[model samples]
Target: MDEETRAEILEATNRALCEHGYAGLTVQRIADESSMTSAAIHYHFDTKEELLNAFLDDLIERFESKLPCGAADPRTRLDGVLDAVFSPKDPDSDGFPVAIMELKAQAPYHELFRERFLDFDGVMRGVVADIVRDGVAAGHFDEADPEEIARLITTMSNGAHARAVALDEHPAETRRVVEDALELHLGWTPGEEVDG
Candidate 1:
């Protein structure tokens, strides 16, 4: 398959998923969202499940690549991550998180989806752990366990999305709570530690 064609199909799949949740998603809908036909999409991806798995793979890769360019300071890096994770999906697509939520709701029945979600969570948790580890190593954060803090943040991040999409809670409130939790765990605050 040509790289361009594959990318087009993936982009179309994302848009279709955003418009129609996982339960409503179909190859025809994806084709309608793109400039391709169902046959063309199938020529590259044998099934809708396969295509969606690929889409999740693409999402994780993009997220991983985007995270490292953040500031070197641990506090700033953590702030950058929280902002990115909680920001609106896009200007026009407020339903993006709900789409993801729907897919997550299916994880129990779909083995591949469960695995994909596990991979996605692992990526986020790993990034958080790395930041926390660096922070502690540099003495910028407290001596608490990095993985524990990462798990706390990752779980809260997931809850924040759920509350925002399902319970009509504002994302900023949850984000602020996560920030306060981080400060409690890390024992550091911005502009408080003098430069050495």
Candidate 2:
């Protein structure tokens, strides 16, 4: 009912998500993890779907809030976006993509889950498209189609996240691949030099 209690519930949900896949997520489990009662959780989110949606919305809001300061040049903004999204700060940040992917793989059987997941994906696509458009106008990036580029970036980010989660690839390597994708596909240069 209070802010602290709400945050604890959200934190518990994330922990449950990491420890137990979507199928295993339950109000009782989350309450136990948070040292609260299931009734408290029910007060905040009546259904499992609502709880999951809140968790995702919170994560996306955090992601949006953490974007780096915008630069005049699009390429710089693009770099800033990458850095913000891939930053290794949030404990579940790196694994979230994979976890979502797994959830998506099951969404068809659950309509609410599928719609919520797709809604987030749509938000991500729109955000990326806007960034690409801004970059193109600034002359730092080529004036290619923004929608296509946004889709490409989203796909690459998803793939990179998947690799990081699935293969246990170093974040540096994932970052390299992402940088290369930007350079080759969008005509942006990496800010750092590669020794290899």
Candidate 3:
């Protein structure tokens, strides 16, 4: 298939994921959503696993695009990353936070699922760690272990997502919960939530 077709397939797959969740996602549904035949999807991806991986690849791209992990200061970068992780807007219309929570539940029994989760988690953790290190270096944050802080931030963010899903709260409320957690954990000023 051509690049455009492949992108269309991925887009459909992403929508299917949001609409049906992981258990209900299928190539037929994706094809239907994309106005293509299931055979066309098979031409690109031989198995459901392959298609799911493609979905994850697309999601990772969206995550990076939506949550630009860049800033001059580590503290500011940390805030930005937190917002990206917990905030809802769903700019890509993927319902990513909910999908992530579902995947978290699926990771234990499925190796492929676990691997995909780890891949994105690794990227997020690395970004978090960099922000922590930069903050410490710039005297914006207290001296601490960057790696540990990164893991903590990642864990907290994921937990917040899960909580948001479980509580059926909007993204802003989820972000507020995470912001409060971060402030309590890192000793940031207990002020208003930072704007994204």
Candidate 4:
């Protein structure tokens, strides 16, 4: 496949998923969102499931690339990751979150979706754990288990995403709670000058 064509199909797939969600998605709908025909889409992707799987891969790849891998310190990296995930936005402005949640709802029935989601979750958890471990070594965080802290923060972040899309709840609300929990347990507060 031409790289441009593949990007177009993935972009169209994102829009189609945003508009119709997983249940109503179809190749025709994706074609309508792009300049391609349904036949062209079918030529590249034999089924809607395959197209969705590709889209999920592209989505996660883009997100992972945006993570703060080269930040100067663990605190900065942690804040960058948290802020990116919990950034405030009008729920109506972005349908991608809703679309993702819709697909996530089918993870039990869709093995591919479950695998991709699990991969994303594990990567994120590992990122957070590494940051926590660095913070502990630098004496920025207390001697708590980094894995437990990462699990707690990531789980809260996941819940925040679900709430933000499903209930139109602001992500900042959960972010504040997570921040407080981190401060209480790790003695590390965002934007504070902790000993290093």
Clashes of each: 0, 1, 0, 0
Model 1: per-residue Cα lDDT over 1-196, one tens digit each:
8889889998888889988888889999999999998988899888888888898888888777767464577767776677667765567766777888888988898788899999999989888888889888888898888889889988888998899888978777877777777778898753344463
Alpha-carbon local distance difference test for all models: 0.82, 0.72, 0.72, 0.86
Question: Which of candidates 1 and 2 reaches a greater lDDT?
Answer: 1
> Lowest-scoring 10 consecutive residues by lDDT in candidate 3?
187-196
Return the lDDT, model 3, position 159.
Answer: 66
Find the 10 residues in a row with the least total lDDT in model 1.
Answer: 187-196
Q: Tell me model 3's lDDT, rounded to 2 decimals.
A: 0.72
Residue ranges of candidate 3 with Cα displaced over 4 Å: 69-71, 91-96, 171-174, 184-196
Supply candidate 2's per-residue lDDT for 31: 85
- Give residue 43's lDDT in candidate 1 (0 to 100): 90
Residues 1-196, candidate 2: write the lDDT tens digits: 6778768888888777767777778898898788889987898898988887777767777666766555435555566677765656466454455667667677787776777767767877787778777866766566678788777767767776676777875456666777787787668775743223
Please give, for residues 1-196, the per-residue lDDT of candidate 4 as tens digits: 9999999999999888888888899999999999999999999999888888898888778778868875558888888878777888645547888898888988899899899899888888888898888988988788888889889988998999889887989999999999999898888887665345
lDDT at 1, model 3: 72
Better of 3 and 4 by TM-score: 4
Worst 10 residues of 4 by lDDT: 187-196
What is the overall TM-score of model 4 with all chains considered together? Answer: 0.92
Clashing pairs in 2: 74-135
Error at 140, model 3, angstroms: 1.3
Candidate 4, lDDT over the whole model: 0.86
